[model samples]
Target: MKLIKKNTERGEEKKKRPKKLKRIKNANPSVVLDRHGNIIRRVDGTEHGDEKRGGQFLAALFEKLIPPGTKAGNKKQKTEMRKKPKRKAESEYNEAVPYDFPGDIIRSIKNTAGDFAGIIGGKSPSAGKAGEEKRGGIRDAAPIRKLSAIRRKFMSLSKAMRRIVIALSALFVALVSVCALNIWASGFRETWKAREASDAEKAALESILDEAFADERSEKLRPLPYRTTPAKLDVRAGAAVLVDTANGCVLYEKNADRLIPPASLTKLFVMYIVFKEVEAGKITMDDIVPLPELSWAVNLPRDASLMHLGQGQTVTLRELMAGLAVASGNDAARAVAYYISGTQEDFVARMNAECRALGLKKTYFVEPSGYDENNITTARELAEFARIYVTHFPQSIEEFHSLKSLDYPLQKNLPSWQKNYGDTLAIHHSNTNPLLGKLDGVDGLKTGFIYESGYNLALTASRNGQRFLSITLQGQGKGTKQGNEGRIHDGTELMEWAFSTFADYEPGKDTSLVFPVPSLASKGNDGKFVNLVPAWKNKITVPHLFGSTAKDSADAVKVVVDVPPYLYGGVKLGAQYGSVKYKLGEITLETVPLVADRSLESAGIAGRFFGTLAKGSLEKNR
Candidate 1:
């Protein structure tokens, strides 16, 4: 009997057939699991094993689907099957057992029946071994035959999976390429926008100024370039500046911020402060300024701008300011200081306070005049301060700049010898602003120079209804041998260049694309359909001066729409439909959505009735 059982088991195992792959009629069979035990991705035949994040996802998914405690059982079964040669051929296991055996019963049976015949014989109490083997063979053939009948099913599914995989790969590559291109475009756009200048504007101005300068030079006009002779300055020891007022920008500079001596330029702030006081009613033109005797001895050589104040001289506050702004007057600065604060020291403290308020980032003053080296500032800071001063006190400053000279009345209380000094003498004063009485658009400003402060100008001008402020400093060159002519020429060249080669461009509507909506409405509650328009126009100014900060060319561009809440459906016009804020160097420009902001009218009377009926039917079914 034992020999008979052994033969039966061998025969049953040998007669087993291959398993049929499960499939739908006319559909493809599922793929075998990949190396990760994950079913191959149906979209693409490219196995999940080849993808970046697929392995971990597959592992997690397998962990969830497999039965609990089945891991060890499956591993043991696989190991035994590999060792047993016949196990590899035992694929015909298609029929499911009708009854579920108890766990304990199944375990005992599995342990006792080590081979195929043992299990079959247990199921049949008296069946012969030959019969058992024959029965097993017939049953095994059923699955193999079913698989053959459905071959067409799996073929179609596999082809579709291959196409899906290829398409997905192409799409991924294209998306990556677009992202890279956008990044490159952003950086290039910034680089192009930084140095945008208007060459055309400069050319037009140059055509005019070059003729003026050439005509003056041909005549060898004294002080035409506003200098006695060619001179170079050692800016390392001190500094100065010259400015063009037309472009509202800088012209020339050299260590202008380096601390040295602030000559009469310190009085520029004093003038600004006094004017502010006058505007605020703290003082007036008629207010008396008590002259101080010591002010005359503050700076040696007496070259400083002054009205030669004597003690007890009662000078009007307005006259004192005129002397300071026009003549760089030290004595006038002192008189104003004394009249306002009763002491020069207190007045200097106020000067320091005003500097901070004006956004003069690099200025500090120790005295009212440029005599003290301790009082100093950068040309840029001075220019900014001057611009602020001009903007605030346009009338007074303009009058001050307009002066060619001034006269002082003899002090009625002065001694006989001093009486001759105070007279309405012909004071021939030249305009100090480099561009003053020079450039057509140029107007009155100030000029400064000291052994320690070099030549400086805080200039401003207007052209085509736009104003500009520029400053030049420390152009005295390496030695006193250098000339202001070169500095003046440099300032002119800079100003002329600024007005050319740049233009403001408004974003045209053609680049805009709109999404169409079947339903649209009008704000008047009249029109049935309305198209959306852009809310704001986008503008960009191109070709600017080197080192100039980027500015938005668009004066007022934004979004216009037909609907109140533009996005009514799940679909959007495009990825860039909402708003795009682009950066060109330091400038930020924005574009808004072009969407149809309209809706279908509350259905006409008949349409509303039909909708109501439809709603009723749905309600009744529910």
Candidate 2:
């Protein structure tokens, strides 16, 4: 092949014909571009001579494309061009080129060369420069650099350590997930448990109501006791209360709502239950109750006061009650409870039920005997209970509570053991109540003592026509004997103070019938209003000084009438309708039930039809 050489110094091209080109063995291959810039293979298909001239031809072609004064050919010129400072004019001229054709072509050629170099040399020159740039960027700052160093160190470690780190990360994530699940589960479980507990409580209350209303005859009794708030008083007992039984008025109280242990004062409820049984005709006083094994066991304890009935002995209900009331016999109390309700627990439940029915809050009974400290009540509630007791079973007080003493198994038939220890095992058990005979007109009440409740008493007294009931609990004393004395002393002082400081007052006959409630059925004179009278005629009491007479005190007291906004027509004569409250200033002295003096019949069918029409017309117009 012949080669053409360029004479750049003289700026001329010279063509020289050489000898036939010799092909070199194993020479690198070369390619040529046609006028269209496409590669063309040699027609001879020989690579030997082409390899020697191919590079020189491409260099010469590139030199022809570049403009004059551009330094791009020689390596030393390239170095000098890079070191030279650019002139202002040249820089502006370079920026003035609208198209970046030369730079683009140069970049393309470099990319192509890099690709080929990577294939041949296993790495590109630009790749190393790019990695070095990345290393010098912001990511190479201290924090990131330290993190990268730690990563490198971790990678350098053995496989076991790397696995340990990965496992720990997994375990941490798993623990967080488990804790979250536990919190969610606990919340759901607590909410479900609370819901179940509320449901159970509702069911229990429903069952209690069912049992209480089981007997049809139970309807005959009052469902809820009347309530009254009176002036506060300072009394020297842990708890004290005074109530007017005839009218259900709470006259004076101190810590009356505080729950306290009742001790044997619980016997009052026992007696109340027994009286209910008697009224039901379930058992009579003369009826005999055989001593059960439980009842006989009462005598085994030295601390417990018993009726002294033997193991196989039988006793009349009357005798048992006497023992309960006068001697405060725990055994007698238990016997009465069991006899009436079949079990002491059942009887205690009955007591609590009755308490609830009577609207007594803060009262609970665990056992019938009240020996357990769990038997709890408030002074105000206990006084209310006593009022109901005496009002319903007046004979109980006279028959059993009034007795000064009683001889069980009578003195005539005393056994040799009792005779030998007559002083210690006396047949006569004196009434536990200290005020029975000591205070005039103080008939029958009960006294109680336990380690928990220092001393307690429920006392009733009457002077002339005035009746008063009082309770004193937790009286101060050093011992049981001293406690009993303190209770009696407090009771006496309270009674004396009440009777001396207050007098019973009755409003005049004209004022007694204050409210004339119109009957809904009444229209004409024949169906006139019914006169409502106070249920308690002379039951109102007031504080009085030494010189004050009942008349003067009654004049000072204010009478407030409270009647229903509307009264239905079909009313019975002498039936309680409303209440009359007596007050002195802001202090309420008493409240008495207001009753219908005359019966009012329901309106006839014709009257009712017209009445309904009239009522509707009035309502619509208003």
lDDT of 1 by residue, 1-622 (tens): 1122235655653333555433212112333455544455543354545634455755454455443467697667545644545532212321222222233223434443443344454433223434333342223233333344233222323476546645765786798876664553333223222221136633543444335334321211112111122234323323434333322223335555665555666777887877778878888888766566656534435566556665555567777777776676777777778777788889988988877765565688877767776777776577656666676678855677667566554455355666676654324445555556666666656666776666665556555544555556555655433535544654565445434423233455334433332221112222222334333332333333233421232223232332232222222211223433333344443334443233223445554443343333333332
Backbone-clash count (model 2):
1
**TM-score of decoy 2:** 0.51
**Alpha-carbon local distance difference test for all models:** 0.49, 0.65
Q: Which lDDT tens digits does candidate 2 get at residues 1-622?
A: 6688899999999999885533222211244445433345543353334333455654554455433454554545545544658645534544553333334333444455554554355443444544312232212233333345345444544588668766766786698876664553333222112211135534543454345333311222121132344544445679998765655555677887788888888988888878888889888998877666677645546787677766545578898889888888888877777788888788899999988887777888898777888899988878888887888888987898899998876533344555544445447789988888889789878887777876889999987767788999888888767777777777877787767666666665335454665455544543435556554343555666324654356457787878764355556655778987777666676676666655557788875664443443333332
After superposing candidate 1 on the true structure, give the runs of residues whose Cα lies further than 4 Å from its correct spot. 1-260, 296-301, 311-314, 359-361, 409-426, 477-483, 501-622
Per-residue error (Å), model 2, residue 169: 99
